[model samples]
Target: MKHRRLEVFLEFLFFGLVMGITEDLIALKFATGEPLTWKIILIVFLVALPFAIIGELIVDRVRWWRKIRRTFQKHVSSVKSSRK
Candidate 1:
């Protein structure tokens, strides 16, 4: 369980990092026409952190819910077929 949680966290962090960098690059291109700086990168990462965490949580929950639904459906189908 702990390992799975860590994996999820890392996955989310990577997702956030990629999103932040992309957005920062686009914004910089339009706003300042400047190359990436360490400061800008840090700022983007910081700003994206919360959004990433929230998105990760939501995604995890949805995945869990889907798994449960699939399991329930499979069980019900099995039972129905057995009865028939």
Candidate 2:
């Protein structure tokens, strides 16, 4: 169980590292016209590392999203009922 969690985390970390570098490099190229540098790569890595974990958490955890959707649905139903 523990090993599975670690494996998933590492997977996301690797995914984030690759995705972040690609997206950041493209953005930097078009947005700033700045040349790629070690500093920029390091910065992208730093930003993406935490986001990878966060993305995993957000995607993995659907309970909160379901709750929010239910609440919204209830609210819309109530509004419709009131109108009718």
Candidate 3:
């Protein structure tokens, strides 16, 4: 269980870091045409820190996802039954 959590954490962290750097680079470049520097890269990492935490805590929760899926399925089945 703990190993699963660690795997998810590392996965999210890597994705967040990659996406953060790419997004910030494009936005900053187009918005200001500023050159990429070590400072900017560091800032991007800082901004993505919270995203990593959120992914680990909220996105990785299987129980919450399952609840959401169940609710959606119920709603869909009800709609189908009404149409029949």
Candidate 4:
């Protein structure tokens, strides 16, 4: 369990880093009419950071939702009497 947790942590870290760099590059290209270095950093922080955070939160919620669904289904079945 601990090993799996560490692997998930590393995976999310790499994902966030890649997302940040990719967003910075896209922002740089879009800002061709203006300065790049500053725009890249600003966009990475302003756009990518929030996006990653929200994405992670959404994924976490989905996992929780699945768990709750399974539990609710189990409870519903248990409360019903089936002729088996």
Candidate 5:
């Protein structure tokens, strides 16, 4: 259980970092003729953290849903086989 939680956390963090960097880059490109700076990058990274968590939660829920579906299908197939 702990391992699973850790995996989820890592996945979340990775997603967040990617998204944050992407966002920062896009924002920098469209800025009002301002030069990019380390401070701006840092700010974007910080903002991306929460968004990343949210993305992770969404992915995790989808993962759980798929697992449940697979388990259910397996159980149903097993019952049908035993009945024959």
Candidate 6:
């Protein structure tokens, strides 16, 4: 469970890094008044906004969700062994 949480966290970190660089490119192209790249970057960055929020929400919930999953797994394992 802890491992799963860590994995999720790492995924979010990677996503954030990618988005950050994309956003930077958007800013750079916009500042330079490049038409094609600017429009593409702008659209992508705008689309990424909702995903960023969802990522943050997932990151926030991972800890609690992991704990709950671990507890449930442990309980099930104990019950099975006891029955055997």
Judging by TM-score against the true structure, name the best candidate: 2
* Tens digit of per-residue lDDT, candidate 4, span 10-42: 678569867786867776677775555775576
- For model 5, residues 46-83, the per-residue Cα lDDT tens digits are 88877777767775567788999999999999999999
lDDT per residue (tens digit) for residues 1-84 in model 3: 999978867887788778877887899899998898999988887887787778767887888899999999999999999999
Candidate 1, 1-84: lDDT as tens digits = 999988878887787768877886788778998888888888887887777777677755778889899999999999999999
Q: What is the lDDT for 47 in model 6?
A: 68
Q: Which structure among the candidates has the greatest lDDT?
A: 3
By TM-score, the candidates rank as 2, 3, 5, 1, 4, 6
lDDT of 6 by residue, 42-75 (tens): 6666667667756667656768789989999999
- Candidate 2: C-alpha RMSD to true structure equals 2.3
TM-score of each: 0.54, 0.71, 0.64, 0.46, 0.55, 0.42
Flag regions of model 2 displaced more than 4 Å.
1-6
Model 2 weakest lDDT span, ten residues long: 52-61
Q: How far off is residue 79 in model 2, in Å?
A: 0.7
- Per-residue lDDT for 1-84 in model 2, tens only? 999988977887788778977897898889998898999989987887777777777765678789889999999999999998
The per-model lDDT (C-alpha) reads 0.82, 0.84, 0.85, 0.71, 0.81, 0.74
Off by over 4 Å in 1: 63-84
Clashing pairs in 2: none
Candidate 3, lDDT over the whole model: 0.85
In model 4, how large is the Cα lDDT of residue 78? 80
